[model samples]
Target: MSTTVTQQPQHSTLGECKRWLRVSLYTIFLLTGQCTATLLGRFYFDKGGKSKWIATSVQSAGFPILIPLLFYSSKSTNHDSSKIKRKRSVMFTLYLGFGLMMIAMDFLYSCGLSYLPLSTFALVCATQLAFNGVATYFLNSQKFTALTLNAIVVLTMSVILIALNTESEDSKDLPKEKLLIGFFCALAASATFALHHSLLQLYFVKVAETGAFSALVRLNFYPMFIATVGGVVGLLGSGDWRSMGKEMKEFEYGRVSYVMTLVWTAATWQIACIGMLGLIFEVSSLFSVVVGNLELTIAPILGVFVFHDKIYGVKIVAFLLAIWGFLSYIYQHYLDDRMANQDKSDDGLQVSKGEEQI
Candidate 1:
């Protein structure tokens, strides 16, 4: 009797599968923490807590925990730093510019949160993806497709609808002038963030290829500089120097347990979420689009449940449209992947036949 033989597909290693599982878990948790920190930072101002205190306290405490992890990861990578030597003045200038922009953006954004609802803030911030997409295409020569345009439009609509319908439960009077100023600030922040991403893609990637520490330092030096400067300026400019000093002193010594707890959550999420997404991208080529769409879809869902932000009819419809647009992009990608795999298999088969004949 003749028996038919079938090829079993090559599966990813158990360790690889486990790694991806861990990444997924980390991603979900990190996203939750990120969204929570963002909402907390925004809501605090509404409740009479100072925005400066919230931003500084949360970020300062949150970053220290992740520093060790980042250091450890940097050490583990075998990349060497000698190849990335740049003139000290050039590096300093780059970071100085970067830092100033970061400080300005953060100050503006944090100030905006004082007036904007959590949902409204998130929706406006969501425009970053669209901005990034356009910027990437022009700066990096990344190709634009119909799906990309559709995704951008859908995301923009989602943000606009959410912003227009935003309600204030307390009905407290808002300083409209300040609020408008804050909105422009947020818009400026978004533009800066987009520009920063493009610059990193151009320069930071090259530095990272030499050493992770160099990359991290290069990436963060400007932001940290910006934050420190802004925080100091904010503290000094608030008029109650004594109270600001006292709060900062208490913050340094860890007197604020509740705030510290929140900071822990933020730090853990920041490192783990970013690390996991990086790992996912390393493992799968299409991880970029997956991560982008996931963020756009999940963040608003989080806002709805965690903040008691309502998803009205227009928002619901807009969100559905966004999802549909993402699905279309994914489907096209699937076809592309299938075709690539088929071509690879054909090449392998031809190589095997040539070897057999020889």
Candidate 2:
């Protein structure tokens, strides 16, 4: 006679529930930070603001945000196994490469934003999702199942629709040449953003053995430190530093208010990144993108109020298409979760069968 001993499953308590709660909150925070940066930048640029160097300062804000994480990472003790993992996972050169790529992505996206209106720029930036999908597949060998394909196609179509809407809306006001320039720069920015993020995802999945939050710290503090320095160099190259204070003082809001906006925007930017890193840590990059895209909905709505953006019928249609694509992607995530649960159940059943035979 064989006695089968069944193991009790681990109970998910309030802590686990709170983890998801935090994820949702973090998503909101990320979106808010992005909106803050975009709007404040618009405010500055719209009113005779001409400091590309400020863009350099904004991204490097990640340097200071990593301060707490530095302490956190230092506290983590690696075991022998983890040490081996680190040896296999980390390459200093790779981190440096990521930072360099970031310099291009940051500078290009800033150029796009500087030229295009907020709503139009946001619409153009949506293409990054499609770029990220392609990059993830190539870089991480992430599979594209039918559901993924459906969502991606929908998103692609939505972006096309948004571009059409942009053409019809305010392209007349902006110089045709500058509009084209913004479009191309935004596209390039999307591409670089995709490559940088995909590489980071690879780094985390393959090499980083630390906990999510710890890895988050390292991602910002390490690659971002170099990226920030590169930005400073880029700023210096542009010869914008000497006139930065002059530009700040001349801002319509007064120097104190302008300085305050930068500080506030920088703080929001850091919080937003923390939220993004948190989501990427808790979930996945694709999921983080979905959460990030939710900003598209928010930014335009806020743009109406802040930038006095006029939303026409074509934009409405584009907005609807965006919602459709987002829903499709979200449904895909649900399908993935269900399939994962089914696999676990099948494994449990197989184990039970073996126990019965014993």
Candidate 3:
């Protein structure tokens, strides 16, 4: 479902520059989130402490961000409350659906991480951008121009190159079936995540009439709360609640490290969500995911240092291609903005000339 809002255009170059600045800052947040998440995955899954509850709890990282949002929302007038209520009334179903989707995504991502090696997982994660871009194009009616399409193609090729000689370190000792299961589960998770990005954008465009903070709050808060509940329920129902102690003991680090890892994971993920949501708000969902995918580029280098994951010449070439693709995407957006500003200036000049004639 889509809702339409007649949005005001930001024609001022200052506004564009500010948007870029904000996006850049937010991109850093997303990058931080990706880096931490990569490390946490290596830490948790490699050690076999795969807690579904932790998977869902990690998303609760955004709860702190939600705190400020709640405060900000409270400062608004009663009229704002009424507006929020009306919008919430319409979005009740979407919220519930997406809340459930969030739960599924968290579970899928956990399973994927548990089953795959970090390098292979990173490469597979790149596909989330492709899934997101396609979804935004169709579901959110976000148009991809020729230049942007070229960028997309380059990014796709980069992933292909990265995966061409891929072998999962974790899969070597495991059965062939586990590898296949991990590959497919990771793919499913990526696709489902893409849907989440697009759907959030749809809601942002149509139903989120408040400030960006409030919109972000709504996006993370409800879904996260539901996901946390789901995790708790799943843990209790599956009797995993009783196994928490054993899982912690099994962690490479002691139980304290296990506790610390989960807390760190939760905090970092929250930080990343802020960056992701901010990017989506400042730019587009496709843009945010594209930036988020830079984690793929960084993760391999990190893997080399931390996990001793092997890297080859082919992977280096793939990394360069990914960089080129990222630059191409940014350049296209710059060109679009330049042309837009030029047209606006020309229109202003024409109006001035008409005034003189008058």
Candidate 4:
């Protein structure tokens, strides 16, 4: 009995360590993949690549890369046939709807990136946290705590600061109309992205019956496949497909560079999506978005160095405000974790006391 008791604690500790390790790994993937993908995406526009349809397509067309991982995971695990049978049709419909939403979100993102400077674009994307908080409140029944509300308000202020400072270096060269379009597109994209996260979380909580990894793969694969098809249709229908060859040849760095840029953009975005889905499966969607905001911080700094984007005072202040907002959200998580641990400890003590009394 003593040995069993000792082994139980060891097992629990090991499990906790594994969970933390997985979370850490996913976070790394999210940060690096997202940052690199964002830069490459900007590079595509900077170097004369066009076709928003193509950009949107690449975001999900790389779904094929998840195939091997899906196969391996499937072979390694046993799924309940009854559950799979019950959920297959429902899952398919959900993925189809999600794929359509992804198409809209990715297209808006492409539009935003096309017209906005990379740094400005990244900062605008930071509003996803605020949007996610609101979406989760409605869709996931997430409570609006003080810190969450503060984060939202601060983040909104950051965006407003950016909006007010239109004469900044990044927007001076561009037409005001285009800048407005980019800003609104980015804001809409952030809201759609938040809604996507909330919907995915709802699916996981109420519908998913498989392992986290398996569900992650399926959620990505089907939606991406559908989105890729939709992107191709849009590309051809818009007559942009004909310009692909010219675009590649006219690219400043040559055809090889253009091709490589799109490929890597696709690859890195897929990696980031995998990381994001893993996090959503393992934690809350809001937690996944919080970790993703790390990219918002890093992307702007990288933008200044790589693109030589000018740093205006307003942008700097806005950046600081965004960071403050993220930190506020993170602290709320830390407090929640402490409270949970305390509750667990209390339960353990109660059980021990009951055992002693018996």
On lDDT, the leading prediction is: 4
Give the better candidate number (2 or 3) by lDDT. Answer: 3
Off by over 4 Å in 3: 1-11, 61-65, 76-79, 116-120, 168-180, 353-358
Clashes of each: 1, 1, 0, 0
Query: In model 2, which runs have C-alpha deviations exceeding 4 angstroms?
Result: 1-22, 76-91, 115-123, 156-163, 166-182, 313-317
User: How high is the lDDT of residue 48 in model 1?
Assistant: 39
Q: Candidate 2 has what TM-score?
A: 0.84
Worst 10 residues of 1 by lDDT: 1-10
After superposing all C-alphas onto the true structure, candidate 3 shows an RMSD in angstroms of 5.4
lDDT of 4 by residue, 210-311 (tens): 778888888888999999999999899999899999999899999999999999999998999989988887777887887787566556567779988766
**Pick by TM-score: which candidate is best?**
4
TM-score to true structure, per model: 0.70, 0.84, 0.86, 0.87
Model 2 lDDT, full chain set: 0.71
- Clash count in backbone of candidate 3: 0
All candidates in order of lDDT, best leading: 4, 3, 2, 1
1-358 in candidate 1: lDDT tens per residue?
Answer: 0111113113323444565575565455545555555555544433334545346534433444546655775677674355335455666677677667656666666666656655556566666666667676676565556775665666566666555665443233577786676677677767676666565555543334544343553345345644566666666677544564355444433446435544664464355335433422332212233344345455556667866766668667656766676566555655655675567656666666677688
The lDDT values for all models are 0.54, 0.71, 0.74, 0.82
**lDDT over C-alpha atoms for residue 169 of model 3:** 36
